[model samples]
Target: MSPLASLTTILTFISVVCAATSWTTTPFNPAAIPLAVRSPYLSAWLAQGAGNALNDVWPTFWTGAIVGWAGFINVDGESYVFLGDPDVPNASFQKAVQKSFEFTSTQSVFVLSAGPVDLTATFLSPVEPSDLANQSFPFSYLALSAASNDGQPHAVQVYTDISAEWVSGDDSLTVNWTTTVGDTITHQVQLEDQTVFGEVNDRIQQGSAFHSTLNSTGTTFQTGQDVVVRAQFIQNGVLANTQDTDFRAVSDDWPVFALAHDLGTISAASDPVIFSIGHVRDPAVEYLIANDATQNRSLFFWSQISTLDDAITTFLQDFPNALARADAFDAQVNADASQISSNYAGLVALSIRQGFGAIEITLSKDASGQFNTSDIMAFLKEISSDGNVNTVDVIFPTWPLLLYTNPAIGKYLLIPLFAYQATGQYPNAWAVHDMGASYPKALGHNDGNDEPMPLEESGNMVIMTLSHFQRTGDNSIITTYFDLLDQWTQFLITDALIPENQISTDDFAGSLANQTNLAIKGIVGIKAMAEIASIVGDTARSSNYSSISASYVPQWQQFATSSDGKHLTLSYGNDSSWGLSYNMFADVLLNTSVFPASVYDMQTAWYETVVNEFGVPLDTRHTYTKSDWQSWTAALVTSTTVRDIFINSVFKYAADEENSQPLGDWYETLNGDVEGFKARPVVGGHLALLALQAVRTQTAMPAV
Candidate 1:
């Protein structure tokens, strides 16, 4: 009898030996677990649901489009699916029982029981904050290791495949692919006709998707229709080692590239079967520079490496060291965050990957088409909102993670904004809202027609510039952009006091006049400017900015304080209206002392009284709150009890099974349901407490 036909005899015995399935989570259960989240284009997640077992449901792009990634294991003639849904019709192919799931700053691990053997699948997206080359490489790793749970030898084989759905969001798009064999076995898939810098439903319309594994013994490869390929492995414990020649639409026959490894028999854990998946697009962004000429900027990794094969080879070889670095990074973040609370640590761990996933580090090509490594810039997408590029307010909230990880990253993010505005292309006196309306395009608003959040963006720029300088102790950025910094600071000086009707970063909440929270941001911005001036040895401007900011504090208090002096109002003279004074965090962050101890105490006490099951509301106007602002509020509060209260509420919301999407920053505080927004980089603000701690530990300021 064939091996598949003979497996029926042992099916009854295998079923009886298998234990009951149960599920557990380490740290806390997140809404959707990150699978392979690197760049915005390369992100994938496994949405948590009652029926969504690891093998039962397919992994999805962050936008909820299915990206077909499937895995299977054949243990002693019995076949089971583990990582994704393979949709095999055979009655013998069973779904593996997931035992546990855990995540850290850099990796997500899922443990599953496949009959008599146990499988541990780890999805690692390296978080190299200090190492730009490794961080910029658009690849994620999937390592699968198996061992016999019955303490007996068992024949085992592992298989994984990626469908062409990963190449483009539009399933009807025609795709062509090829297989290459050398030091590594790689399958490359791409659209037949590419539209450079174009996107359909946020998935780049250009770029080749690479699914690769080392060309080693016991490994076989195949390409064909998904069902055909998956069934071949189920019937036989190995692949046909052949490529399908047809080039067709992504949805036509559901073409897939697959690799399988045969572990003859295993009593102990077998060596890991590792696969690397990445999407590569040259000339990653279209950027407008000081000369008013548009230039194509490629990913920074291309500058350091000569070829894609070499890049993949080095990346695969560096896995041991890369994983070690990521492990150390996760441990450090956990250690620092646990000092606050275990709940706080979980929040930080969940936010780290989502925060950095929105950014891409790129280098500009010179006249000869050679990438200039020195001309590097980092661009961020205002994901799931408007798709704005390098949005000042978006960066403002995301900067905490950048600041805590590597302050130089924060500097790279700012360079594009400064470079664009420095050319006098932006017609606004205040900072532009964002470099571009959509991501991967940094064309400046030469017509001065960008969205107007004059006071908001102005304050954000000044505060972030100072924050970067404070963390890195690099005064060069301050002196280099002193003129434009003064321009934005001057705008803050004019509008900060009493504040005209304008929208803040929480623009979705709508515009308000004399906004108590917005007014404080501008005031703190002026104070931050004063420090920036001092750092550059501009004593005249330093004293002037200091005097102005010092004078605005008492006036701001008068306009914003409640009748009972127990809390701050939402707007001037609105004694009955109260809101989260998150802007006060910048004062504490900068050590400006602009808002006195009484202000902190009053806000802390009032927040405790008004706290909801999920979190404190953004204001009395709505039950919804912004998680980023709530975290900033948590960092500034003097009461540790109040701090934990805020942290626990956000943590509770994140752990809610119903809140299943990549962490949304805006949600209803009453029910912990997402109100609007998802997968935003602003969730990085969740690390505010860590950034604040780092800043406070600096004993001496950098000399001028």
Candidate 2:
């Protein structure tokens, strides 16, 4: 071959590589993307629509606090931004290409090109629920990999930044950061002043610091108001070559009190920090390279006699296996959901992430010593402090996921509430609405009122208890709380048949007297108690409660059912008004036979007519709807066609931009806009219907 021809061929190959890697400036509009979804404190998400601007909309803690921004890609002498703002145009991007994005339960990958170099940034958190170590890890991995799409050589560099706000409760505090370089580069940042932990609402933690490290050779770590990390990608190799880095973010004194509540000042100096870290592998690396790499790349040994290093070392070694479990979980959920309907599948996928993601398993221990065993008597945080654990109403919506996914995990949620009641902290004859105490600080009922929900909460407790028993076929949990359930069920027997003005779960819509739906819940709760009684061999109580429940059904129907029989009146003695007695679906779910199957048919038909373009209104009182309840109602329809109609209506409502704010449990059905509440775990309520269907169909669900 002629020398001139060889030179031309090589140049052509390089240009093609550059063209493929060249960045395409595409519009960014994601409803929301999950990142680092380990717990309430560790959970983070990136709101879409920022469009090539990383800092445009800062990453948010599930609580809605801005954690920081961490996305940027630079190649050779040119800069093309894959994440955040691109301040400078890169020669790399002079010729544009395409960008692609992929998201899964545990990972999100973004691929962008700048000239001949292709860059892919992956955000991964190992959230296998069965693996306590991986699920409890505080760190998420941010991996950056680069390669030459074409066949020629190219140069590349990448940078990422995180703000000091991550560790600061407020900007008024002085910010200071220090840098340490060993085999890896680490940057630690914190506020100069620290405070002890206390019980408070909407409170952010203080007295904590974050340690972020870049795990790579030739890494540069810089700190200011925001810390930045840069790494060398490639020098002079085939543009087809690759380079990337492993990044870790850890907060010392996490859970600031360590769930110990020692009472001595809960400052960093006094309390032990919760230790957790994550590990990741680059796909670009071959098995030989990975196998030969240092096994203990990111372990931190702070104490002379501590085995923190070994613990982390073992975890990092087993990281890949944990990730495999996470993958299987995602696949099973995705497949199971798809069988219901496309919209149902989408809802389930998002619901699983948003609903389960909001819960934080704060601590795990048993009857043994504090650090004795790994058996997790774990407590889940409600994300919003106001809706803390065992908020019966809140748990009502969030039950399906736990019940269907892992009944054992569901038991963990209720055990704490039962323990609190057993302590006599809750001395009420009737069930309280919540375990009392705002998140992470459950001493007793903290709603600051006596029996706030009265009928509503009592009914919720009895009904969910029955549900737990049905799902697991284990009466131990029900038997353990039998007396309490009996008392609550007895309360329902008195006040529920014809409810007085009292708050229900839909308290935001205001209290209503003689609420027909609340009455239905009462009847259902009584029936549920009957089932639990039967489970525990209390045949006499079971028969008596069953008869009482049966009698109430006719009385309720006489007053609450519309004369036309098309829909139920919103309240008793108000035949002209209407609302969703979605509670009726429970009768169908429990196969209780108290309400005839024809009743479900009648309500399903009625709901179809009441549905607007967005969805069916919750009741005649307003055009607003609760998404979770809507899902339950939709799932009640026996006909697939009718069920799909309701599912699509709510799906469209959720897809609307106005309702695009992190799956609000409550929204206006008229315009598909959020009325209130977002990022709440109650979306798990949507899973109730799915769980029922799963059992009826005898379908296998993901084994937690």
Candidate 3:
């Protein structure tokens, strides 16, 4: 069924059918607690588990930067802390128990019971694809609903506060405040001489955060270096099922700039490369007038509003429907996960949420002033680790989720590479490995002393581009970039069969001469190009590439196969060692005849033997495994039993108590311990099975 129709059915019978999911076995520990994950920049999560302690550790960015802390609740003149620090206990409150922690596609609800009162704090950052106005809106809603559990009338009050540390990288920034005519308050906190996307540096950029409260008493002050905004309310003589205050937090990097005009391109010897004039926006002003509709842009994120009376009023007025949509989306995701397996339902739920949460969409205005979420003029991938578009290799794992959500987004992701190249970003024959700019900037390839992974990235780009075409059945995208694809294919034709020792995507594992697995990638890429050529009616070119790819299959099988036939060697002319020849598995996934089914069976059987307690290693070269690539290899297995063995193993790793970070992509296979690269968007790679399923069933991909 269509997602909308399925959601409608769920909403119709929700009360009767929807049962609350308890997450005690895999409790809501703070390895990942997504509170506000609207974009890469607006994302917030808890670093430490706050199960029973209301006053827990401060919430932080994926970079481990502190965003701030919020806590405290009062009932009838007695106080209780439910969010941050609870050591200074309150008289009227015993320790609150987190009864249930539930998540949807667009919302998270935490059920907490304190004394006789039951509270549901629903955190909503509506990501409804059907409503651009709500999706692009920067603000997140912290809606609190309270009721009497003991069936007695009582006066109740609650308080939540955020530190000014949220606005800028430096907590010393001066903050100014304003109170709207309505029941609202706004704080404009920012650093001095703000520059958005100026230099490509690794330090987190300083920006503005507008904190506002709706229908509640608000206060702002400086407590040491922290700027604190507190919103508290009292419902006199409260009855059961009463709604209290709602808090809104909106953040943006204003003076946003992007390359608008194409700079003329020349050669590698050309001195002093230049950039064209760009667009600069005042995010604060834009926030005030986002609803005007007269100032529309084609940018990814075009919505932001201050605590002005009209802005707060509109948000509150439209919140009911927005929230309803979020609940419906949640129900749909939950229902879908349940169908997979009760053991894996939560794992799937968290995976889907974390996958989509890593991307950031910025806004841009067009000539017509019509807000265009469709154009996605600026699709930014935040380098929570290194702040580079760090394209090709990094985006390889993320392709599965993007393909399953919208194949168009897969095309959109490639646009930046083309855009950077058009402006002479990199002077390479194949695809650019990584755009040099640090996080929040997409200027160009900026790694000063980095070596380009010609084979790794080129193979990745071609394979992903072809996968996008297969899912979308869109021939135009391939045609538009045919020249680029042809150039890369020709490069692969030359170097794929006999690769020189060079840095690959897995550079940490060091270089390898005649890398066998990488050769498979090039082979798969060539075959994909042939398929694309046929789709675009280039019969002669298709025939030429088909023969080229076909020749490599047997050559690779002969050289890469271990003498015992138990595994494939990691490199050519070496039969003792084996690694993930994951790229070759694509032939089976694409239903192509390039690689024989025996190749896949042999690799799968060998991997099962090597499986550790956590997962199969990335290769025989290292004990560390990548969750994303592991998923790709696991999807290649034909048997459901074999596939579940791998999937559940990874699921257990995700639920492990020690690996306490947001989905670490790299980890030790034996102990399920994180090695490095934490909280990355590559976690989306775990959804590769979804792409395989979509292709097999010919089902419409889910809208993320």
lDDT of candidate 1 over 1-704, digit per residue (tens): 33222223223322332122257777766778898999989999988742255776789998889999999999988899897876766535988998888899899998899999999999999988777888899999999999999999999999999999997979999999999988798999999999898888989989899999888888899999999999999889899999999999999999999999898899999988789999999879999877678988888888789999998878877777777888888888899899998778989999999999999998987889888888879999989998889999999999889878887888899999998998998988999999898777889799898888999899988998898888877876788898999999999999998889988888888989999999999999999999998888889989999999999999989889988888999999988898989989989988888888999999998887887767789998898999999999999998887787788778877876675678899999768789869899999999999999888885221111
Q: Rank the candidates by TM-score, best first.
A: 1, 3, 2
Where does candidate 3 stray beyond 4 Å? Answer: 1-30, 49-54, 86-95, 129-134, 177-184, 198-206, 216-299, 303-316, 337-339, 363-375, 423-425, 446-451, 701-704
TM-score of each: 0.95, 0.79, 0.81
Best by lDDT: 1
Model 1 stretches with alpha carbons more than 4 Å out: 1-21, 698-704
Q: Pick the candidate with the highest TM-score.
A: 1
lDDT, candidate 3, equals 0.57
Each candidate's lDDT (Cα)? 0.87, 0.57, 0.57
Tell me the alpha-carbon RMSD of every candidate.
8.2, 14.0, 12.7
Error of 1 at 16 (Å): 31
